[model samples]
Target: MAVPGHKLDRMFNPEVVAVVGDKGPGYMWLRNNLPFKEKGGRLYSVQLDEKEIPGIEALGIQNFKSMADIPEPIDYALVAVPRQVSPYVLKDLIANKANGAGFFTSGFAETGEELGVKLQTQLTEMAREASFNLVGPNCMGLYLPKVGVRFNADAPVADDGKIGFLSQSGTHGIMFSLVSAANGMHVSRCASFGNAVVLDVSDYLEYLMLDDETEVIGMYVEGVKNGRRFFETLREACKRKPVIVWKGGQTEAGARATMSHTGSLAAPQAVWDGMMRQCGAITTNNLDETIDVMKLLLNAKRPTGTGMALLAQTGGQSVSITDAFSKAGLRVPRFSDGTYTELGEFFNIVGGSFQNPLDMAGTIQGSMDTLDRILRILDADPNVDAMAMELSAMFAARQWKGKPETLDKTIEEIALHKERSKKPFLVILHPAHEAEYVASIQPKFHAANIPLFQSFERAAAAFARVLGGGGRARTRTGVVGLALETQPR
Candidate 1:
């Protein structure tokens, strides 16, 4: 049993930090942007010769010549200087007994250089001896809202507190933040641990499990720091909060390329699949699906074990959603005779027969109204535990004509009214480009605990997955996009 508590406390709640680097955007970025000036986490800047960056307010202390100059007990260090100079920096941190460090400078083993690999090995040895945890020699560290922790112009976690995202690419970490923000997914923290030297994915997983702020966890992986330990952490976290992994650089070809870059060993797909299932982790097909499930798990009710409901305004959508439920291995239970009769009473408008995929348009006119009826019907059905709504805003110029165009606001209201239900509720809006307006609905979904997705198929699949005992909890959801995030203009 790896104890992650002591390591996590030193990282997130660090009281003093030493950032070593040349005059570059990375170091200056932190100085100008860190929100911790008020958190009392003292920051010390280190450079070989240069001093006095242009915009920083004078802290009155001269730029430290070395780690020894800083008399304070440094909790964390960021080695962002040139790669050639990194080993020395790591040595300094170790000598000072720094709690941990996020080594953002690349060009080590990842560069495929013999000397670079040697550098990483030596630094790892030094770190182990010093008893300090390390995140990356070529990565971004972690994000924690509770302690005012973040990187310079990095980590775009929304202000809401719903999930935590961890990735191996700092780029993915930053992009996930922005996409999560655009989609309205609030997060407790997001970390991009590149080239893990000491602390790796498993370490973060253990920490997030104990983190009261996170309800779910999302990961984008180029490599796992330790596979066995990772599975151990995943097993425990899945029992608590849902864990979703997007195994990037996943193919054999891509994995081979990874070894040269970071000496990483990508696992086989079959092995990965069985591992995820045993630990109860939801493995995604791609980056898109990964983010889709992450946001939705934040909204799903609970891992209910087998049925679903499909609600759409049009028969075509109903047909597609029904097919999706079937393919996902979930049953769309036909409405009970009594339930059918009650819905039939309103058949004057909804002429279609009331079935599992109820095209309830007669009495339900708007997105809000349609969803309301669907919710009532599904809630009453013990067999139907989850639902998928195919929504194409009538106002969306490309799809429908009657859309209130105000569907975002209307959807917001419905969620607010149904805030208490834990059943998996999802709406898949057809692809469109009115980004700003469509994206506006995100905050409300997060607020109401219902998840909104851009792909109808993903929305349906997520519902089936959770209800079929293949996914985690229910009701509210979100999407952290990588490419084609269904951005609202």
Candidate 2:
């Protein structure tokens, strides 16, 4: 599907790309790092410097003396030239009929200088006249792995991914892309539309809605070009797919920083909250929470109701999980007599509580035999809409340090239960051991499509978010539908 206001093909899947101002070491490093040359997209180094530019020829990039001298159609240009000469370089690019341009050079509106602002305006105006999009005057630019385009050298390039990310800050965009990859959420496209002179957040959201590859969108927005249009677009996108927003510039000091950083007028926190609530979009304050929310959407089943049945190894953790769920407006209801009778067969009353937020100290510590039965029972229970289990894999690893086989068996059981369970199941893995231990088990859990978190609070919060702001327990009527509008506060 064709995206509006931006020919994303040229913006991302360009046939031929030119990197202007390739004289310096920075551009050389970037050119060396671009992995797309071997992956179908042809790359060219446009350098006016006839002098010997070190390390240019070795990369096998087609070098050109000028934009017009390239002698081929230029789909997109990454202009890294100085602010003073950017206009002239852009003019040359337009003359060559380049479809889109991403200005990696800063010193535009962000500099708070009239000349910089004027130059930025001129560039966008020229792009508009040319009937293509201007991505940024101060950004890292696109990272669409499907077509072999990326801004950072080390960013992961997946054949296909589901996340569609758009960020106002270039650094934040890189962070989200990398972090999402680490958490097993692959990104389809990431655009850092710095200063957003031409293509803003609203346009990107619309494009993501139409893109078949994107199932979820994670946005890092500081400001918007049009508030009403953005809100309406956000509402529409939410109806189609999950839209996770991380609005920076919430504090007074942060607002000042955002203005200087992206030349954006950060809206008030109250207004931002209202928009998110009205649009049925999830709010993530930081990158970790963003990943947390995305992980829930990608891995877990959409909840039919807010009734949660938490099973924890430790009594303290059980209490904490219940508190967190309560604070988030989710319910931790009592188990039915039938469930209690069945649970009694495996759980000896000596060490655990069978009530809601079931403390499975004895069962967790002793028996792996009852694990599947426990999961199946919880899933079948009419009172339990969702389930959360705290598994201390790190502690278990420590106890069975030499027995990697035992650990694997335990994880395998959890994975098997996750596949068979009808209700949404959340596994909270407490990283109580060294980084290596946690790392070893994370991939296994991720492989099983089980949502894993380091703490109960985070897990509970994710469950609550899935429950649409969780309140009193609601019965599982059917598959939970997406929240179409914000419930009044």
Candidate 3:
């Protein structure tokens, strides 16, 4: 039976959450619940062991001997008991009528042992009979920042994040949330539904599609139980919100690995690819590409066309930038005749070239006013649909030796130009060896909402995907999909 929408809502944004079987060694799940408590939500610890009670109490959480002992209803419960003990705990949760429960216990069907399969079947039948909302028999469930719920203690939480993510692997879920957050993209909600025996991926997809807080949806999946329902929900979701899917187990070896990992039947590669294309959903290979694509979809303004204007600090960088963007299916075309006339007036040709991929080696030696003029010329060029600039930390550190304020002012001018210009603007800040220099300017560009990449290749690949209609779907009449309409920026 499908869980009610209201019940799932309570589970994601629970007012009262309980952590069962949390012990003294690490107090792992107990520590995970501290964020919820810090956000003013009620937290209770269900530990029958007298040895564990003191540890739970020391953390300032109320300890209960059993679920029945709790005075109020539980919106969500995290169970981490042994496999044999889980059935007993499920009875308690079912009787308590908890809105939702996630089992962190392993040794279920994924074990492929007779006892493991039997235990999983037993739990699945019991939950279905009672119409209970179970997240996973082996998973690190929900991470809703608005409710201060998180699987990892260090995971960031903010009320204004717009990215929603779902993963079949707990490790991917944790890493994706952290990586995306570090790159200025915060997650509104993230779920790591492992061995999804009850509530599957499609259920979460439908909910996230309708969620007002979630503007873009990203998923990491091993496989699905119901292929028809999964793709059907995906098709509908792509119409309402941009869905980026990172499917695991495309190869034969990977397919075998996924079965052991999640007890999922991995789909054939050809079928998976065809269905994703038919649904108009975006596909990614690895975690880095997934984050890169999501960053562009959430941050960059959609380019009118794939035409790009590249700028770099050196001649070698200019050549590499042109090759990278061009190879990624984006055009680095020549400037219009009028644009060349305007640049010829002040752009020095002795140390710089003012062609398509402008080598601005000499331009940066001039004042910020001069650099701003070059940017304005490119922004007004009809041949340029988008612009990408390579900012070299080594060059900036050498040229501005002690004038740090000048570098800051130059960045601000570029940001202002991007804000008012019609073209999408991007920055590639390279060579992490100069961490101090890159660190100083990263926040300034991020605050101004400019998409910053560490390499030209990464920026080019992400930009090409965005320009190829990877994020937005168009209707027969040529109108933007609902996802684009509802998306902010």
Model 1, span 1-489: residue lDDT tens: 113455667766677876676364335535532655446567777766554453233533235777888987778777777777877887788778787888888877777788887888877887777777877877877665445566645444234656778888777776776666556565677777888777778878888788777778888776665565676677788888778877765688988877765556676666665666666677775666766776666665564645677777667777887887688777788767767776766554436546778776544655566556556756677776666666655434333234545545566655753455656667776656656555555565555556777766777666655543345333221111111121110
After TM-score superposition, the amount by which residue 465's alpha carbon in candidate 1 deviates from its true location, in angstroms, is 3.8
The whole-model lDDT of each prediction reads: 0.66, 0.78, 0.83
lDDT of 3 by residue, 234-334 (tens): 88888887888999998999999987898887777777876676677788889998888887787677667888989998899999999999899899888
Compose the digit string of candidate 2's lDDT tens values, residues 38-73.
777778888767663445665677677778888777
Best model number under TM-score = 3
Off by over 4 Å in 1: 1-5, 22-28, 31-33, 51-62, 152-160, 349-353, 367-374, 395-409, 420-422, 433-436, 467-489
Positional deviation of residue 483's Cα in model 1 after best superposition, in angstroms? 33
lDDT of 3 at 224: 81
- C-alpha positional error of residue 12 in candidate 3 after TM-score superposition, expressed in Å: 1.2
Tell me how far the alpha carbon of residue 316 in candidate 2 is from the true structure, in angstroms, after superposition.
Answer: 2.2
List residue ranges in candidate 2 displaced over 4 A: 1-6, 23-29, 52-54, 365-367, 469-489
